[model samples]
Target: MTVRVRFAPSPTGMFHVGGARSALQNWIYAKQQGGVFVLRIEDTDAARNKPEWTEGILSALDWIGISRGSYEGPYFQSANAGEHRAAATRLYESGRAYYCDCTREDVQARTGSQYQGYDGYHRDLGLGPGPGHALRFRTPDEGSTVVVDLIRGEPTFENKLIEDFVIARGDGSPVFLLANVVDDMTMGITHVIRAEEHLPNTPKQQLLWDALGVKPPVWAHVPVVVNEKRQKLSKRRDKVALEAYRDEGYLAGAMRNYLMLLGWAPSGDREIVEWSVIEDEFRLEEVNPSPAFFDEKKLRAFNGEYIRALPVSEFIDACQPWLTGTGTIAPPPWQPEEYDADAFAAVAPLAQTRLAVLSEIVPNVDFLFLASPLIDEAAWTKTMKDGSADLLDAAIAAFEALQSWDAESLKSTLEAVGAERGLKLGKTQAPVRVAVTGRTVGLPLFESLEVLGRERTLTRMRAARLRLV
Candidate 1:
């Protein structure tokens, strides 16, 4: 049988980081098995579904290298409602399932405990289907169902412990559990590689697959992604959106590389490796079954490494979205006309080292393009203290007389000015840096001054000296 796997996501909100990880895992597994990767939108929740959310899911998948057309049908689950209902009917007719009118209150009244699950009150009742009737799978009371998983070992669930789950609602529409299984069966999925959160429902789904007279797919429930507190990463509390990271200037390669390391690592000592390396070495069996922590700080550090590893040209290209505020990125502080390409290219290497994300590119280079430095109030108050007025005067005079305006010449020139004041280069450049770049710290001071050029640098110094007066 050709190996088939599906990445089914509900188009409700942002494409979650956890969901992205699952998609990548499924994609890799399929590729490794020489199988097909399917993209299925579980847009069955009509109350929460939107067209844009579906498109966002597609775009996010594309961003992570799961490009459109590379995978099978983005076959929507809603489109297969008929199949879902038919499977529900077949299960009921075969004695594997039955209909009953049991509300939450009714079940609670029967069991006398709100904490307990359904009491199987509807199992043997020959109640005819009606407006209030719900279809539930009649779980066997004897043996346990063993789910063969790739990452996790065979997880056994007792039939007695498993509740008689509802397959279809009172309105006769199939619920997610039945619809999911039917859809998987319809698509010929050979593997079910999903997050560990779905493990509880696996036995039910597996039962559905069996009752429907179809063999269940191979299962591999990867570890649940958690936050620093070990709580499952939640949209309300955590920055879990993949698009948020993408828009923040994270390289796709870096994001995906870090994502893979959430539950599994490559062979040997390195966590950061090429995509080709990951594709070659990734194995579901090797994945750790513990909860994977989504460390944002580590991811940023990984992104920095990725940004620094980039070829200068590629780095420049990558920074464009944040640089120009194009696409989904917000516009930079400077106007479009003020952005100087040659000047940015000159300082791009210097800026590249300091940036952990692409968004930093704008602030690092903003001072170079603006007509006047966008001074930071606190930096100005802190740096332009007592000898600053005198220092700017001396530095401006020294800079004006310079024969060549380069980073080397500029550094030596400022060094001498600071020396004359019995101060170090750090002290001397503090006022100059803030007088130029809005921030106290940024790209190498001399390199930045060189890019800013002789005229603009002097004009800014004179402006600073006047501000001090």
Candidate 2:
């Protein structure tokens, strides 16, 4: 049979990194096997589901370069309400499911413990009592269900310990368990790759699948991504939103590459591999069983690598959005139309080595585009106070005498003036660096000077000398 996998995400807020990783693995698996990859929006909880949240999932996936129209849909779970209801009704008629009149209070009183979840007191009862009762599947009492896991190996769950989970709420609406099972069956999903937190619910889903007479999909429960403290990534407590990364100017390629390393590393000691290489070598069996920590430092490093790899034009374009505050550009924020592309190109190589993210490009190179260099009072006091004004003055005079204003001429003139002042190139460059770029430690001084042009550079140098005296 042909391989088929589906990424069924709930219409919650911005898709979590955990969910994104799951989707990525599923997509890669499907692509590698020449199988179909499906996108299913599980928006069954109407009360909690917002339209914007649904759009957020789609947008996040699209931003990560996962294309739509390649698979069946963006099939919405709400749209399959008829199928869910039909499947639940069939189970009820076949003695696989029964109506439970047991109220939460009733179950709690009999069990004497709220900690163990719902007691199975009403399990054997066929359509027992009350009109506003929920429909629950009859979990088998004997034998254990073995999950032939792709990563964790064979794990067993006793059928008796599995509660008779509710398939449909009293309002006749299908819950997540039933809706998921029916949809996956209908969609012919051959694999179910999801977070390990869902592993506890797999046996319940497997029981429902058997009750409904559908073939159970293969299961692979990847480990949860954790924070530094090793706690699972939480929406409330953790910085788990994917949009936040995009907004902070992380390249999607970089994020994808970093995510790929979370649970599964590439062959040998190599960390940075191309997407095609990842797709070719990615295997469900290779995924780790332990949780992967979300390391911002490592991710930033990878992002820097990806940024450095981009073509100069692409890097310039990528920096645009952050520069101009306009979001319309492709690789939006990479390079704004208002930015001087030639200036950017001149300094791109210098900036590439120093920057860990595309977002850093603007601040590092902002001196070129800003109307004036942003001089830090501390840097101005520290570097410009000690005999640097004389050097600035001499450099300005030398720069004025230069016939050409290119990087070559600027470098030679600045070096000559610094040598006259008994200052080396490094010491000489600092005052000019602060004067031109408004700070120390940025793109190379001469290259930045060339971009700033003869007039702006000389003007800034003059301004700094005046500030010094």
User: Which candidate has the top score in lDDT?
Assistant: 1
**TM-scores vs. true structure, each candidate:** 0.98, 0.91
Going through the candidates in the order shown, the clash numbers are 0, 11
Q: Tell me the deviation in Å of residue 264 in model 2.
A: 1.7
Q: Candidate 1, which segments miss by more than 4 Å at Cα?
A: none
Question: What C-alpha lDDT values do all the predictions have?
Answer: 0.93, 0.84
The candidate that achieves the highest TM-score relative to the unseen native structure: 1
Question: Which stretches in model 2 have alpha-carbon errors above 4 Å?
Answer: 124-131, 328-338, 420-422
Alpha carbon deviation, residue 373, candidate 1 (Å): 1.2
Which TM-score value belongs to model 2?
A: 0.91
lDDT of 2 by residue, 316-392 (tens): 77877776776632342233444677777788778877878767776698787766877777877778766887888
TM-score of candidate 1 versus the correct structure, residues matched by position: 0.98
